[model samples]
Target: MAPLRIQPMPTYMDIHEIPGGITADEVAKAHAHDAAVEGKYGVHYHKYWVNERAGKIFCLCEAPNAEAAMQVHREAHGQTAEKIIQVEPDVADLFLGGSEVNSAGAVLLPGGAADARDPGIRTVLFTDIVESTLLTQTLGDDAAMELLQIHDSVVRDALKALNGREVKHTGDGIMASFVSAAAAVRCAAQIQRGLAQRAGEQSNHPVRVRIGGAAGEPVEHGNDIFGSTVQLAARLCSHAEPEQIVVSSVVADLCIGKGLMFRPLGEVSLKGFDRPVHAHSVEWSA
Candidate 1:
């Protein structure tokens, strides 16, 4: 089955504390813009309530990941949330229980059942050098080593600028995680552009990197994250062409207003996934 046929899941939820208070008109306006902004990135948002006395608002959204939800909030009104959290797909149904079952098994109703799972979301990024073996053969060990160092410098600079954490080195590449999808996408584009610039600056080894991004609930164990999301991101990197940035449908949806453009590649078979994944190629130049 194609991913488009599957039910959409609510993966992120956040509570914004409006210390100054908010109005119905403001909520209505935000919701109207959100409907358009988030749909491009592949999510849905509904304003639940406005606590006038406490000056708070609760919002529920179905997003590919936490970054997408946060992006919508940030670009919509500059009201970037203080904290955004991941909602377990199963647990989402617990709060929205009324009649329609949320992606989570729980129904939406009064005194809704509480979900036991933890909530938080992250965007995982993976990148690798293209044809390293061939490059090494042509450039020799000493030249290849220097090229590797250049790659490290460029990527490390991007990580620092975007506030991303380098999880580990995957020999010819690296795996990193970000709190924001916007940041991750921005970092990936910068890395590509940076590498292109370096290729022109140095005449020795012109290296191109392939990048893949996916957002989801990632379980952190030590320095590494082990989950379907991580695996999915890694698979995407492997499938990408040199200097190309590939992303899942979730990533594409979350990145709608972030200045990057995506060209749809349609639903394609990815390793391990039972259904075809909807993938996109980031059009960094345009």
Candidate 2:
């Protein structure tokens, strides 16, 4: 008879929403409670983020199932989570990055003082060279390579200025993550504008690109950042016109009062998503 295989428990990110607000100390006590009882349920509560001003707390844990994870909370402090989403541990580490955890298990900013908490929210951005294959076909290998270099230079420069981190290069595009949604939007705009100026100078290549951005936690379904947020950003990028910028509604909402302009694209159908996503077009020209 073949031996039975035991599957690994999944990692989950659970959100807790308090009415007024919550403090780090309060969450620390709650986390201590959870840790004391989690072993009984075969669950492990890892780290947590507390947005004191926003009255939100995000806890990362591993359990046999969502119910098992919640049961630990229910038995410990009676403060059930608002929602729990399974996430890919590797991808979460990639996007959210690692942080310093206090003895209480609350995540803190990487080099910041004890009070500076890391929110665990991130903005994901993608940039694709419009008609990259055709550009290569028409411009020849050497010229296409030159234009690609220009794209890399401009995007990396913008990322550096806006504090964005390049996750990976996608051959024809780039994927990046930002701690601030406003910074991500600004970075996208800077890239588009920079490319436009470069296009005018290098009229021969006239490279044009499209950008898309979305904001969300690190919850994901696959090894890669195929999380809904990342997927929406990629879909919006493909849906954009040449030299244009498109972003998800949450990105727009997060950029409110940041002096950016976005025209509503309404709800648009996107591949791999069950429902239509509301998108916005960022005005980056001039």
Candidate 3:
């Protein structure tokens, strides 16, 4: 499995081409069947969209695997999915928060400022919420929103403290960039540690974030960051346990003797990487 993932697990946005047009009642029946039996297959039917005039419908789900997402519909409702594609979400803060980053990809200290854009060499960071769907189901939208707000605040505060540039939100996660790999790693640890401590003493709805990072130049497009570095960071984040921080070899190399502790997990296979990547999990035990 690719860790706990930003959206809880691997997600597939399924496409259904309904030649006869799907009806509201028919969709309801399928949803009911899913609600009844999805747990059997370790899947969650997130939602669906209907285009009656065009005879097209889109279904969203979080499943252990694509096969599971397909099997649930095949066995339960006979609506075999035409396609199951893994997807990433698009989310970001209204604006970038923290001190400005310099042209040389250096973070200005607090109360300092710099220019607007620099897609230069940077340490990209990613973090995700665990089992968020279940949280939303347990607590209504209103309540879940409350917890998410706090999570955003905590993340933003940590980024500000470290002078990280808030790139965007990833639905249940956040993406930020740092000029220094050590700062990024330390900030990731801080986010996890602080949230863990708070979850320990707070309300019944606990919060956890999986943190991961990689170092390299990233391509900025469509107001979002991309390229292999960002993807690898997210892949590592998905491989991280709740309240855990994982970093790539690039990050590990950059943080050596920087007073950061990392345990090497040896060569491990990460999705989309040509070969297994040697990764390290940040040790955060007190």
Candidate 4:
């Protein structure tokens, strides 16, 4: 039997908070642009509402996938989305669950439902050294250690500026989390750009770093993140070129309608995963 299709199309939608100096009329034009792109992709876009208090415009769209939907938002709008969330495959039906079904899905005794599940909405970031093994072989332990210190200094400051929480360090790489996916993307980009500038100033061998990030539910345990989703984000770091940021569809969706840019790399399967994940390379602002 063929699988059931829930939504007519897969779309990434969000609520964008308009930056100061932008008028509602301007936002309407941007929304119209997004509508046109959705039509080109064979999807319908629904303009939900305009928040007068917070100065935000909310929209819902349907597209081929999250990336395509995000592309529409990024290309069409210049507003920063406060929250871009996945509507989920079958969110409506899930709400139909009664008390018995709901209780059955609860966490183990005393753990509560929270412990068994992640909030399902978080920004996951991965960072790692570039050419560490070769640098270690050539520069030896002493010099390599010094470079690592520089790497730490660069990322640590970027994370702080972005208000990110340090989850832990995976070898030379660090896994961090942010409340906002936009901040995570911006933070990673800033780190890379900062390191590049710092490297140029130093006369010695310049150390470079690569970063990867995703936004999704990572199993949370006592103020730390765990589970396969987090691992996938960490592994994505290796796939990134030096000074580049690779992010998953999850993160891509969360940044929709934000002024941020991205260049799609299509999709690729990560190790120990059953399916391929859509990934993108962050496009730096001009």
**lDDT over C-alpha atoms for residue 124 of model 4:** 76
- What are the candidates' C-alpha RMSDs? 16.6, 4.3, 18.7, 16.8
Identify the runs in model 1 with alpha carbons over 4 angstroms from their true place.
1-119, 219-226
Task: Give the residue spans of candidate 3 off by over 4 A.
Answer: 1-119, 219-226
lDDT of 2: 0.86
Score every model by TM-score: 0.57, 0.78, 0.58, 0.56
For model 4, give the 10-residue run with minimal summed lDDT. Answer: 92-101
lDDT (Cα atoms) of all candidates against the true structure:
0.71, 0.86, 0.72, 0.65
For lDDT, the strongest prediction is 2
Q: Per-residue lDDT tens digits of candidate 1, residues 63-88?
A: 87878888887777767765556655
Error of 1 at 267 (Å): 1.1
Better of 1 and 2 by TM-score: 2
Tens-digit lDDT track of model 4 for 1-286: 9999875665444556555534445655776677766666565565433433445554555667656666676666644455555554343112111112122221121122542321225577889888888889999999999888888888889988987777666767777877678888999988888778878888587878888887653222211222455766776777888888999887888899987899999987788667888999998731
Worst 10 residues of 3 by lDDT: 90-99
Compose the digit string of candidate 2's lDDT tens values, residues 237-257: 898888888999988999899
- Candidate 1 weakest ten by summed lDDT: 103-112
Candidate 2 residues lying further than 4 Å off, grouped into runs, are: 1-12, 16-22, 37-44, 52-55, 61-75, 78-90, 109-116, 220-226
Superior by lDDT: candidate 3 or candidate 4: 3
